[model samples]
Target: MPPMRKWTINGDFLTLSPNGVARYGREVTLAIDDLLAAGGPLADGLEVTLATPVGGHDLPLRHIRTVHVPEFRRPRLPQVWVQLQLPRHVQGGLLSFCNLAPVAVSRQIVCMHDAHTWLMPESYDRMFRLAHRVIMPVLGRRARAVATVSHHARRQLAALGVAREDRIAVAWNGCDHALRWRASRSPRDYRNRRPFVLCIGRNQPYKNMELIWAMAPALAARGVEVLVAGEAGGAGALRHGPNVVALGRISDDELAAAMEAALCFVFPTRIEGFGLPAAEAMARGCPVIASTADALMEVCGDAAIHVDPDDVNGWTAAVIRLLENPFERLAMVAAGRARARLFTWRGVAETWLGLMAAADGVPVQAPGGRGAASAAPIVAGA
Candidate 1:
C-alpha cells in the first residue's frame, strides 16, 4: 500500500457569500472529490477532509471527510477561525482555495485567485485591502506553494512582490459548471422580451459597470434592452431606467437562460483573475464582448470581441454589430464554446493534486508523466 497522505481543505469559503472566489473553491473541491472517487494513483492513500467553521454549509462529497471546527466568539470570526483555530485541526498538509490562508502553515498550498487587493485597491474597502496586503505576502513567502487562476494573475502576484514567480502555479478556473445549467428551466420567460444584451458583475469600481450604464441609452435606442445581474447595494440607483433591467443576484439557471437568449454578453471589467463570467458565458454558447484586460485577453483569446474597458463607443459598436450580424454571431458562439472546452474542473483538480503532492515531497507524475513539481502548462490562447 502507498503511504498515507493527509490533507485538510480550508472551508472558509463555504461560510462566505457566493462569488467568483467562493465558486472556484466549491467547484474545485467537488472536482477533487470526484477525482478521488474515480480511483487513480493521485488518489491512492490520500485522505482529504474539509474543515469549516461550525455553521458552514455542506457539500455533496463522496471521497472526502468533512469536519466543523469550533470557533471562539469574536469579531471577524471567519478570519480568526481560519488563521488561528482551523490550523489546529489540520493533520498533515493544508489546502486553501481562497486568497487568505494561515500564514504559519509551511506545508500547504494557497490559491490566491488574484492580485486585486494590490492592483485595484480602490475596488476594496481600506480594511479589506490592508488585511490582504499584509496577509497575502506572508502566505506567499511562508507557504510551501502558491497557486493562482491565470498566468496574468501569477505574473501580477510575482510583480507585486507577493510571491516569487517560480513559487506560483497557474490553475485556470473551469467553465463546465455553466454547461450543467438548464437553460430551459430558467425562471425568466424571455420569449416576448425585447432583444437584450446581458451583463453580470458586482457594482465594484473595477467591474467597470459605469461603462455599461453609459452605453445603456444607445443600446435602448437600437431597441435592445440591457439585463444586469449580480449587482447589489448602490446599484439600485442605476436600476431606474426602463431600458436597463437590474436582476440583482440570480440563480445559475436564470443566468444560463439569459446568456443563451441574449444578443450577447458584455464584460467590461478593468481587471480580472480569470474573467470567469466571460468564460462561463462562452461555455453557455453566448457570444461575448469583453474588455482587453490581460486576463480577459488570455481567457477569451480570439473567441471574444475584445474592447477597451473605458471605451463606451467601442462597446456599443460591438454589441450592435453582434445583434445585426447573424453569421458573425454564430461564428463567435462556435469559437467561444470551443475555447471554453479547453478549461475543465478535472484539469484544475489534476493541477492541484500535482501541486499538493509536490509540496508534500512525494514523487508523483501526472497521467502524461509530467513532473508533479511542474504544474500543467497554460493552455494555448487560454
Candidate 2:
C-alpha cells in the first residue's frame, strides 16, 4: 500500500526550467521543500515525481514516475494538462493532497497564487482566461480546502463566491535560501557600482510601471537611479533610457545581488494578492516603497512607503521623499527587517497544518493570536 503515503509531490514545474526562467517562476518548483518542512507524519512518507531537468538528474530512479507529456508549451498548457492528470494517478493512495493548479481530486488542497486572471485579462490570451475562469470555480467548489497567499486574496475569493470563508486559508510566502545567500554578500560588489532603487516583477500594465516611469524624474532628483528586473511583457521598449537600468532576465544570484545593493525597493503595483519581491527585499533588509493596497499593507506593515499606484504625482512625491530623507530610509530598512522576520516558512507550514487538519475533520486548534504579532502597523494620516 505505497507505504501509506501522506503526500505525493508534483514536480513538472521544475522540469520546464527554460520556460520557468521566462515566466516569473518561483515557488511552484519549491513545493516539495515546503511539504517536507512541515515536519509531520507527512514528511516521512513524502514521494515526488522527478521531472526537474537539473535537480532530477541525481534523484533516486525508483522514486520517479515518468509522466510522458510535453514539458513545455505556450501559455503553460503542458503544466495544466499534467496537473489535471495527477488526481487519477494518485487518487486512493493519499490521506491528504495539495495541487498548485486547478484539478479534480479528493482530500485535496490547492494554493492559487493570485486572481490576476481577472485583474489583467490583457496579459493572457482569451483561451487561457477562459480555461482558468471555467475551471478554477469548479476546483474551488470540489476541493476539501483552499489556500492562498494573502488576506486580500481571501476576500477576493469570498467575493467571487469561489469557496466558503472557513475553507479558504492564508499562507504567507517565504524568502528562500537564494535571497539568504545574497544577503551575506558585500553590498557594493553585489549591486552595480552605483546607488539605485530596485523594482522587480514583470513589466506589465497592471503592475503600474507607467506610473513608476512617470515618477522617474522625481526618483532621479533624489540622486537614485531606478533599476528594473524581469521580463517586459508588452511590445515597444520601455522608456527611462539611462535613468533606469532594465535587467530584463537575470540569474538568481544576480537578482539577489541587485536586491542587496538597492537603496530601497519600490513597487507601486495596482493589484497583487501577495507582493513577493517587495517582501523579499524587506526580508533582505531593504526598505520597500509600494502602493497602499490592503494586500500590500498587510505584507509590508510599517516598513514600507505607501503610495497611490494610480496617483502619478503622489507616487512620484513618495519616491522623492524616501530618496532624500536618509534617516527615514534607514529607519524603514530596520523596520522592514523586523517586519520580514515575522514571515517564515515555519509559520506558513503551521498555518497549512492547521488548515489541513481542519479539512480532514481533525480537531485542530483555531488560529488564536498566531499571526497577531505581524499584522500591518497603522500609518499616520491614513
Candidate 3:
C-alpha cells in the first residue's frame, strides 16, 4: 500500500471573477474531485482538501473536503490572505492552480499559467505587473514544483528566469468544458442578420483586438459582420466600421451561440500560455482562424487556419474563405473537434496527481504509464 498523502488546494481563484485562469482552476478541481470519487491507484492513500478565503464560491465536491480560511483586513486582501493566513491551514502539500502561491509553503506545487506580466507588460497595470514580477520568481524558486499550461509557457517562464525548465511541467488546459456550453439555451440572440466572424477577449493590448478591428472594414465589404465580445475597455478608441458589433461581456451560453452562428472564431492574440478561447471554440464545433503565436500553434495544431497577428489582410482573407466554402468549414469543424479531444480535464487531473505523488517521494505511473520521479518534470500527453 502507498503511504498516506495529504494535499491542500489553494482555492483563491474561486473568489475572483471568472476568466481563463479561474476557469482552469475550477475545471481542474472538478476533474480532481471526480477522480478521487472514482478510486484508483492515483486515489489510493491520497487525501485532498480545498482551502479558500471566506466568501469563495461553494463548489459541489465529493471525496474532497473544503475549508474556508478567515482573512485579516489588509491592503491587498487576496494576496495577504494567501501569503499569510492560507499557508497556516495547509495539511501537507499545497496545490495552487492559479499563478500565485504562498512562498512560505515549500511543499507546494503552483500552476503559473504564463509569464504574461513580463512578456506583455503593456497589457497589465504597473502594480499587477510588479507584483507578479516579484512574487513569481520567489514562488518558482521556493515551491516544490511548478506547472504551466503549455510547453511555450514553460519555455517563457524559464527564459524569464522565473523557474528552471526541469522544474516546470506542462499540463494543457482542457476544452471539454466548452462542450457543455448550451448554445440553444443562450439568452441573447447572437445570430446577426449578416454572417459574423466572432472574436472574444478583453481590450488588452496583447489580445491583439486591433487586428480584428483593422480587418473589419474589408470583412464588412464582403457582406460579413465583425462581432467583438468580452469587456470593451477602449471601445471609444477602436477604429471599426459600422458592421462591427460590440457584444460586451457575454455568458458562456451566449458565447456558444455566437460561435455556433458565426462564420468562424478569430483569435489574434499576440502571445499566450495556451489559447484556451480558440481551443474552446474548436470544441464547440466553431472553425478557428487563430494567430501564428507559438502557444496558439501548439494548442490549435493544424486544426485552425493560422494567420500572423499583424496581418490584417490575411485574417480578412481566412474569414472570407471560411464564409464562402461550406465544405472547408465542415472539414475544419471535424478536425477541430478531434484536436480538442486531445486535451481533457481528467488527463490534467491525472497529471496533477502524478506530480503530487512524485512530490511526496512516491514512485508512481503517470497518465501515459510512464514512471514519475521526484526530480523529473511530467508533461501531460508526453
Q: What lDDT is reached at residue 13 by model 3? A: 90
Q: List the residue pairs that clash in candidate 1.
A: none
Candidate 2, which segments miss by more than 4 Å at Cα?
1-5, 16-80, 91-102, 176-178, 183-192, 233-238, 367-382
Every model's TM-score: 0.93, 0.79, 0.93
**Global lDDT of each candidate:** 0.85, 0.61, 0.85
lDDT (tens digit, per residue) of candidate 3 on 175-207: 899888898898888675679888885868999
User: How does candidate 3 score on lDDT?
Assistant: 0.85
lDDT of candidate 2 over 1-382, digit per residue (tens): 4453344334444444433221222343244355555446534444434333223223223433434334334555544544555455553222122224535565666666567677688867787778667766776787767777777888887777767777777776655443445434432354445568778757566787777677777667666677777775222334564467676776656666777778778887888777777777887777787888778888887778787777777766666666678798788878877777766655565666565556545565765332235555534324
Worst 10 residues of 1 by lDDT: 369-378
Model 1 bad stretches (over 4 Å) = 74-76, 232-241, 366-382
Estimate, for each residue in 1-382, the C-alpha lDDT of model 1 and write its tens digit. 7578999999999887756899999999999999999988778778999998887789999998999987898445447898889889888999999999998788899999999988888899988998899999999999998999888898999999999999998888888988989878877876578789988858678998888888888887899888888863235634535688877788889899888888899988999999899989999999998887888888888888888887888888888888899999999899889888888888899989988878767787742321112222222212
Which is the leading candidate under lDDT?
3
Residue 93 C-alpha lDDT in model 2: 23
> What TM-score quantifies how close candidate 3 is to the native fold?
0.93
